[model samples]
Target chain A: MTVLGYLANGLVFSSIIVLGSIGLSLVYSIADFANFAHGDTMTIGAYTALVTFGAVGGLGGAVLGLPYGFFLALVVGIAVAAVVAVGTEKLIYEPLDVDSIGLLITSIGIAFIYRAVIQIRFGSDFTRFGIQSLRPIETLIPYGVRVTLHDVAIVASAVVLVAGLHVLLQYTDLGRKMRAMADNPDLARVSGIRTKRVKLWTWVIGAGLAGAGGVFLGLFNQLSPRMGFNLLLIIFAAVILGGIGSVYGAMAGGFLIGMITQLTPFFSNVVEALPIGQGWLATLLENLITLEYANAIAFVIMVVVLLVRPNGIAGEGAT
Target chain B: MSLLADPKAAFADLTRPERWVLGVSVAFMLFLLGALLTGALGPTYFLFLVGLAGMYALLSFGLNAQWGFTGLINFSVAAFFGIGAYGSALMTAESSPIAGGFNPLVGLVVALVVALVLALLIGIPTLRLRADYLAIASLGLAEVVRLVVLNERWLTNGSAGVRGIPSFFKGWPVLSTFPETMPGLRLVVIPGSPIILGTSFWEALLNVLLVLTFAGVTFLMLRRAHQSPWGRVLRTIRSDEDLARALGKNTYSFKMQSFILGSLIMALAGVFYTHLNLYVGPGDLDPITTFYAWVAVILGGSGSNRGALFGGIVIVTIREGTRFLNDFAIPIDPAPMRLLLIGIVIVAVMRYRPQGVLPPQRELIWPSAVDGGGTTETPDSGVREQKGGGGDE
Candidate 1:
C-alpha cells in the first residue's frame, strides 16, 4: 500500500534471490552449466519445510519452543534439498559428463521430473508456512516504513548464510578447492585437487542454499509447484547480471534486479493513482508496462548486461 | 578363401554391420508405418493423434537442424511456433475488432515472414554468446513472447485466445462438392461399408495429408541442405567455430542462416498446427512445447533428419498413448505421471546414449579404399566435445 511497503517487499524479494543465486553461481562456476533445475530444487526445499512442520509439529512444539521448531524445520529442509541436489547430479548429470549444453538439457529433464513429482504429491495447490500463526511483529522504521518480523527473520538468515559462505570461500580449504575447480577443472584435476569431492561439496552448499531460499520465499508469499519456476528467470537474471560464477556478483545482481522488478510495478501503480486526470497517458503506460512484465524486465536486464560485458559485471571470462 | 576371393561375388558384397543396420532400420520403419495405418483405419481419434505426431516430427526436424547440425541450443522453438500459429490466426480470422479477416494463404506468408524476422532479431545479438548464455537468453525471449501474447488484449485477445479461425479449405467448392462431382473418388477402402464420407472426415484426411506433405518436404530439404556445402559449413561451425573461422568462413553469418532456416521450418509447423486445431492460445506456446520438440530431437538423434522424424513420432506416441492411463484405477491423477515419464525418458536418453537412438552420421564419401585418407576430423565428434570452452574469443 505504501512506498515503504514496496521497499520492504523489494528487500525481502532480493534476499531470496541472493540466497538462491549463490548456489546457482557456485554450481555454474564449478559444474559448468546453469543448472536449469536449480529453481525446482528450491521448490523441493520449500516443500521439505512443509513436510518437516507436518511431521514434527507436535514433538517440536512440546519439546523445543515454537521458534526452535521452526528453525529445526529450516535445517531439515536445507539437508533434504542438499541430498536431492547431489542425487540428481550423480544419477543424471555425472553419468552424461558431456558438455555444458548436454548438462543443461539433462538439468531441464531433472527440472521436469522435480516439478511433476511435486505436482503429483501436492496436487498443485498453494500452501503456506502459517506465518499468520506467528502473529508477526511489525515495527516502524524511519519515514514510517513498516517491517514485519518474518521479513526480519528472512533477511537475518540470508545475511548469516551469505557471510558464512563468504568465510568458507575465503578461508576454508574446501572453498579454495571449489574456487580452483571453478577457475579451471582440467588444471584442478592435474593439480590433484580431487575435483569430484569439490563438485560434491558444490552441490551440497548450492542446493542447501536453494532450500533455505525456497523456505524464505514460501514464507514471503505462498508455496506452489510454480513458485520456483516462476522466479527462475529472475534468478537467472541475477546470476548472469552479477557475473556468472561470482558469489558476490550474484548477491549484488540479485538485489539490483529484485529492486528493479518490484519497484517498477510499484512505481507504475503510484503514477497511475496520481491526480493527473489524463486518461490516454495512463492507458499508454498500462499497455507499455505492467506488473506482469517483471519477468520481461529481468530478461531485458540480463540481455543488456550480457551485451555490454559478455562475462557479466563480476565475471573474469566464461567459467 | 576361394569364395571370398571371387571378384564377381565381391561386386555385390556388403559388410555384416551394414546389413544389420539396413535390416533393423527397415523393420523399424515398417512397424511404425503399420502402426500409423492400422490406428488411422480403426478409429477417428487415431487419425488426429497420428496427424499430431506428424506435426511434432516437423517440429523436431527444425530443432535437429539447429541443435543436431549447427550445435545451437534454441530454447525458443515454442515462441517461433507460437508466432506461426498466432500470425496465421490473427490474419485469417473473420474481420473483428482485433482480427484482419484475410485469406489463410496470406496468413501462411505472413507467418513465414514473421518467423524469419523474429529469428533474425533474436539471433543476431545473442547467437555469438556461449551456448549456455544463448539458452538462457532464448528462454527469456520465449517468456517475453508468451507474456506479450497474454497481456496484449488488443492484439492477441489477452489470455482467452483466438478461436473459430477458418480451417484449411473451408467452404472450398472442390472439397465441399467432391461427393457429387467425383462419385468414384468416394469409394471407401472398406467395401460396401455404411461409413459415409463426411466433411469432418475429409477435413481430417486433408489435414493428415497436409502434415505429411510438410514433413516430407521439410525432411527432404533439410537432408539436401545438410549434404550441401552450406550444411557442411554449419557442421564445421557446430564442431568448432574457431576452426571454421580459421578456414576463412564467416561463421557468424552461417550460424544466423542456420538459426533462421530452422525457425522458418518450426514456424511452418505452427501454421499447420493452428489449422488443425482451429484455435490459438498463449497456453499452446509454453516452454513444454519446446521441451517436447527437444525430446524428439534428442531421442531421434540431433544431426540426423531421419532421426529427428523418428524421435518426433516416438515422443508423440508416448505422449498420446499415455491417455490410456485414464482407464487404469490409479489413485492419483495420471497427467503428472505422463510428464514424469517423459522427464525420465529425456534423462535416460542423455545418460545412456547422448548421441540419441541413431548417432549422427558423417557424410559418406566412398573412395578407392575402405578407409578414406581424410585429414579432417568428423563433425559429430567435434560437436560433442567440451563446448563449455566455447563463446570466448
Candidate 2:
C-alpha cells in the first residue's frame, strides 16, 4: 500500500477515535472524572444503530431521499446513547456528586453493568451493519492507493462533527458556559453560568458523539460486545495523550494515535521491504513487534507523552 | 516517639464491645466459609473457591495498601497479577514449547521483581498526575500487558497459553500419602480422627496452607507498613501533596514506594493463583480480574485491610456460591447476572457508603491520658482532611 493509503486508513481510524475522545475529553473537563463507561457507551451506540437499522429496514433513504438509511439510524443511535449518559448522570453521578475516587469507581461499575447488559442482550455474538452490498466507492490514487466511500464517510463525518463542535465552543453561549464550567465550576456558578445546565449539555454532546463514533467503528470493524471496550483504552490513551481537558488536544492525540496504531504493523513490512542483504532486521521486527501489538503502541505513546508532559500537549497544567 | 504514643491507636480505638462485634462477625463468616470448604462435596470444588477467595483477599490487601493507605488508584491489578502468574508459570510450567523452565520459588521471586519494576516504570511518570489520570494510565498499562501476553507467542505461548504448571507442593510426601501414616503433621497430631483426613484432604489442606501463609504474611506486612512512619508519610501525601512536599518529604518517592509495595503483594497473590490452578492462560489476566479485586476492596471497605479480606470472601462466595444455581437450570444464564449484580452492588456501595463498610480509622494515636500531653499527633490533620475528601461529590 502507498503512503496515501495508510494516511487515508489512519484518517478513517482517527475519525472514530476523535469522536469518542472528544466526548471523553469533554466529560473529563466538565465532570472532573474519567468515565470508564465511555467506551461501553460507544458499544451501546453501535448496537443501538444496529437495532435501528433493523427496525427501519429496506426503507432505503425514502424519507430523506438519501443514499442510505444509516444516517437516520445514526441519529437514533446518538439519542439512545445521550439518554443513557443523561440518565446515568441523573441517577448515579448527580446523586453521588462524583468528585472523589468514588465517582471513578462508580464509572467502572457502570462500565461493567453496561458491558454485561450488552452481552446479555446481544448474546455475545459478533454482529455487523450488513450494508456491505452498499460497497465503498473505491478511488484509485496515482500510486495505486485505494480509498473507499466508507473511509470517506468516516473522515468526512468526523471533520464535520469536530468542526461543528469547534464552532459551538467558539461561538455559542452554551459552549462558552460549558468551557467556563470546565475551567472552574465554582467560578462559573458564581458567575451565574448555570453549571448544572452546562453539565447536562456536556453529557448530551459527549454521549451523542460517542454514539456516532460507535457506529463508525462498527462500520470500520466487527461489532462485538468487546469492540468498544477494546477501543476504550486507546480512547483513554488519546484523551490523556492529548491532555485531559483540551478539545483540540483530543483531536491531535486521536489522529496521532490512530496513525501510530494503524502504521505499527507496517514496521514489520518496512523491515521486510528493505533492501538489506541480511534478513535479521525483518526477522527481528516480525518476532518482536507483530500486528497484534498495535494497541500497545498507542499505550507506549500515551505513557511517553504523559512522562514528558503530564498535562498533555494542549493542557496548561495539571488539573 | 513518646512512650505514650500508641502506634496501634487505630486498632486500639475499637472498644471492647466493638472488638467483640468485629471478632464474632469475622468468626461467623469464616466458620461458614470453612464449613462450605470442608463439607462432603467441598474438598475439591469448594476448596478451589475458597482458595480463589484467599487470592482475591490478598489482591484486595495490596489494593488497600495502595488506594486505602496511599490513595493511589491502581487499575493495573490484573496486569501485575498476570505478570506474577505468567512469570511464575513460565518458570515452573513443565517443559513447554516456550518459556524458561526454572524453579517455582525462583519464579515467585522473579514475578515479584517484575511487578516491582513494572510499578516503578508505570508509577514514575503517571503518579505525579492527578488521581484520575493515574487511573487511566494504569488502565492503559494493563491493556498493554494483556496485548503483550496475547501477541508474544514465543514468550507467553501466545493465546494458547502456558499450561500444566506444577503445583507449589507438587510431590510432597504428606500431600500424596495417606494421613494415617503421616509423620508428625500438626493436623494429624491433634487428638481427633478427622473424617476427611486422606491424601486428597491433605492436598487441599496444603493448598489452603499456602494461601493462608501468603495472606497472613501480606496482612501483617501491610499492617506494619501502614502503621510505620512510611505509611504515615504515604497517608499525608494522599491527603495533600503540596503540604507533604512543603514538609520536606520526598512525596514522589514515598508514593512510588507505596505503589511498588502494593504491586509486589498483588503479584505474590497472582503466583499463588497460578499454582493453585496448576495452569496459566492469557484469559486469566483480563480486566475483569482487576475489577473483581476492586469490587472486593470497595465492598469490604477501601482503607481497611480486614475489610479487604471480608470483601474478597463475600464476593467469592457470591460468585462461586452462584454456580450451584446454574446446575438447577435457571431461566437465564446466571453468569452474566452475577456480574450485573456485582456491578449494582459496587454502585450501591459507592453511592451509599463511599467510605466503605469500615471507614478508615483516624491514624493519630492520641497521647495517653497520663502523658500530660493528650493532644493528637500533627499527622491527624492530614488524616482528618483525607477522611473529609472521601465524598466531596
Question: Can you tell me the CAPRI class of model 2?
Answer: medium
Per-model RMSD to reference: 7.3, 7.0
* lDDT by residue (tens digit), candidate 2, B243-360: 9899999988888888888899999999998888887788878988888888888877767887788788877866865665666656446667667878898899888877677655
Give the range where candidate 2 chain A is weakest over 10 consecutive residues by summed lDDT: A58-67
Task: For candidate 1, write residues B214-278 as lDDT tens digits.
Answer: 99999888887886779889989988989999999999889998899899999999999988888
RMSD in Å for candidate 1, one decimal? 7.3
Candidate 2 stretches with Cα past 4 Å from truth are A62-67, A133-143, A271-288, A315-319, B1-41, B98-102, B171-198, B362-393
DockQ of 2: 0.52
lDDT of 1 by residue, A185-222 (tens): 99999999999989999999999999999998898889
**Model 1 segments more than 4 A misplaced:** A58-67, A130-138, A141-147, A269-286, A315-319, B1-42, B95-97, B171-173, B176-197, B329-332, B362-393
What is each candidate's fraction of native interface contacts (fnat)? 0.68, 0.63
Report lDDT (Cα) of residue B257, candidate 2.
Answer: 84
**Global CA lDDT of candidate 2, please?**
0.80
